[model samples]
Target: MPSLRIACFHLNQLGDLVFSLPALLALGRGFPKAQIISVARPPHRELLLLSGLVHNVVERPRGQLISKLKMVSALRSMKLDLAVLFSTSLGTAILAWMAHPREKAGFGKRGLAYRAEKIGPPSVANNLRLVEALGCRVEKRDYVGLVKLDESVRCRVRDLLMHAGIGESTPYAVISPAASGRRAIKEWTSEGFAAVAERLADDLDLVPVLVGTEADEVVAGLSEKIVDLRGKTSIIELAALLEGAHVFVGIDSGVMHLAAAVGTPVAALFGPTDPAITGPMGEGHKIVQSDVPCLACMKTSCREPLCMQRITPDAVIESVAMCVSEEKNV
Candidate 1:
């Protein structure tokens, strides 16, 4: 008999893709001999390839209709046995439908052979429901990890730190002060982050490290002690940095989830987003949010954004202290 050929239509963003890891883990467990292929966009495609979860990855087309059509032709040639859709977009649904898989699994009633309710549970647990619809036994411990990094990747990250004047034995705190899109309401004040960085240096004795894309360089020039690595590290390199951190301080964003995945204790500042729905997974996470009435409104634009403003720097400092102390105890 021919080996089973499976395809996973992956989610687009870094954190969303990380949330879907457990479901992919379920697929691997359920079909141990299957050759799994993932359809993902760049950077994430590279991240997934390094993860060792999928057998191969195909770059998802973007921008042009001609590129999408070419991808469709390529998928059609593969003659996929099963197509698992992690993205609920209409374009992804259409792509999977055009591929003509013998079995289809996805969320909602998008004409799939197996469907799971998109709502309910945290994002990670909700993703697991999709694979459970296919009779996969979801393991309790599978939801905690992100990707496996080889020794070479770690060594490269170490060299990067050495170039940045940080020694091998140095303990650092990674802080991301930016949120994606127009969600300015999700970000804490720069002054707040600066205060936290000061406390991390003076109180906790950890050097502060700023991380994000070039677009996320909002926290730069805050402190000379803070090492601004924003726009410098790739996604995998960022993971290595987070893995070595004493703790991560950030808003509700993809980097925060990445920190959690790499087993770094997260001191996450929450405002408009609900922590239960989209917060970091696993243990040793400290969530700092005000007790506002409109706490989890999910609003992208807010003139005042009282929820974020109300979160005092002292509160965040306390959380960071707790995170460090907890990690030391463990």
Candidate 2:
């Protein structure tokens, strides 16, 4: 019999794609003989490739209509047995329909064979609902042990740490103070982060290493005492770095999700967004949210985001310390 051919339409944001890992893992376990393919962004494609879940990845289309048409033609030629849309949009639904897959799976009644509706918080469970629509039993819904980092990547991160004055044996905490896109209002203050850095060094004996994209450096900055690694590492390399860290402290961002995926303990600070909807997954993670009445506002921008500003550095230090202690116990 021919191997079952599956195509996963996975064009998603970084955290959203990470949220989809458990469903992908379930797919792999359910049909071990199948050839599963994923269509995702270039960076996300690398992530799925490292997870060892999908057999191959095709770059998600970008730019003009011609590019999308080319992608549609390529997918149609494969005669996919199943096409699952992790990103449930009308446009994506149209693309899946154009591909002419034998069967289709997605959220809502988008002319698909299988459909899943929005569920409760902790969005990982919601992602699994779509796969369950395909008759796959999801025993695990966490990305903790799904993605494996190569030894080479670990060595590279080790070298990077050494250069940054962190030895391989040094206990360190990764701090990401910036949130991507319009979520800037969700960020805790730089002053608060700097104070947390000092506390990590002086009180907990953990070095605070700042990590983010170049665009985030200005927003995530601490003093010269902190080792800033913004724009220095690729996504996979960042994963390796987070994997080796003692703990990760950050706002609600894709970096926090990445840290959780690598099994690092996370001290996530939340304000404008709801933690239950998009917080870090799995165990050994701490969510520190403000007590503001307007919490979980889900607003992209706020002139005075007192919710984030209200979370003091002392609270964060306490959470970080707890995460470290819990990790040590583990």
Candidate 3:
């Protein structure tokens, strides 16, 4: 549309950035000459850099109103032609309005001042599926695939694999045991992940690469056999590592979404969250959840987490085995 400059606002968590990759791809294809700019958290800047579709990344600081005002001023300088707010936050819509883009699009029940197109009811599933609902005339809608890595990051991942004693020819599965939130109800136990990893290692001969941020180190400590790569790799490097892995097994976390974005087959464990809404969007994703009445409550704390406790290690092991076998056959 005459070399339009587009700005996409997704200042949420790391997984949110990953999930929005498909929409970014669609924008790139739909407007080939458009200069795509992404405004997101600092931690996700690397991800935006790795995504070849983005022309620039505007980092939004989580701080006072003065800081946000400064960011808004910076966005104003960009002179964006179109803005897409992928997040459901009012702040994002406000930022888009502050940018003064020609056209703004977002999803919310209430109307936003600058948002020209508003998709009804902001749900997790609808948010992820917005590439289609937004009604952008594109050939494909299911573009939520893995993000590409820069050459430098690819080289770093290769070196990391070599340093870990994992040969290029060796097969491996990635296990991410930690979720982002502090809610114990949402997370499966560390012992369950350990058991799955051990079984996968023993039966399938697939080495398990444990991945997460620094906060997940304690969970990583639970597994002695796994190659503890927590807090060791950057966002781009993690994408490269996930791209090479045969499969990914993890709880409902950002890494799980990252794995799905990377186009890796995933077997995810779900507890207090609804898989139908937040599960990985892909063909090869297999979600395991228990039938507990209190499940999908999205509660932060609970004395009893039957939803997660019922998801035994044996079930995960079996799922892993099935995924491994299917991959081999492919």
Best by TM-score: 1
RMSD from true fold, candidate 3: 3.1
Off by over 4 Å in 2: 64-66, 120-122, 219-221
Q: For model 1, which pairs clash?
A: none
lDDT of 3: 0.76
Clashing pairs in 3: 146-261, 146-262
Candidate 2: clashing pairs of residues: none
lDDT of 1: 0.85
Cα distance off (Å), candidate 1, residue 38: 1.1
> Per-model C-alpha lDDT, please?
0.85, 0.85, 0.76
In model 1, where do residues sit more than 4 Å from their true spots? 120-122
Single out the weakest 10-residue window by summed lDDT for candidate 3. 113-122
* Cα lDDT, model 3, residue 141: 40
Candidate 3 lDDT, 111-207, residue by residue in tens: 4323333333233334445544545444544435547666788789889998998888889999887766654567777778888878778888988
Query: Tens digits of per-residue lDDT for model 2 on 251-306?
Result: 99888999999899999999988888888888999999878899998888899999
Ranked candidates, highest lDDT first: 1, 2, 3
What ordering of candidates by TM-score runs from best to worst? 1, 2, 3
Which lDDT tens digits does candidate 1 get at residues 64-156? 988888888888888899999888888899898988899899886857899888884337777788889988898853446647777888898
TM-score of 2: 0.92
- Model 2, residue 16: distance off in Å is 0.8
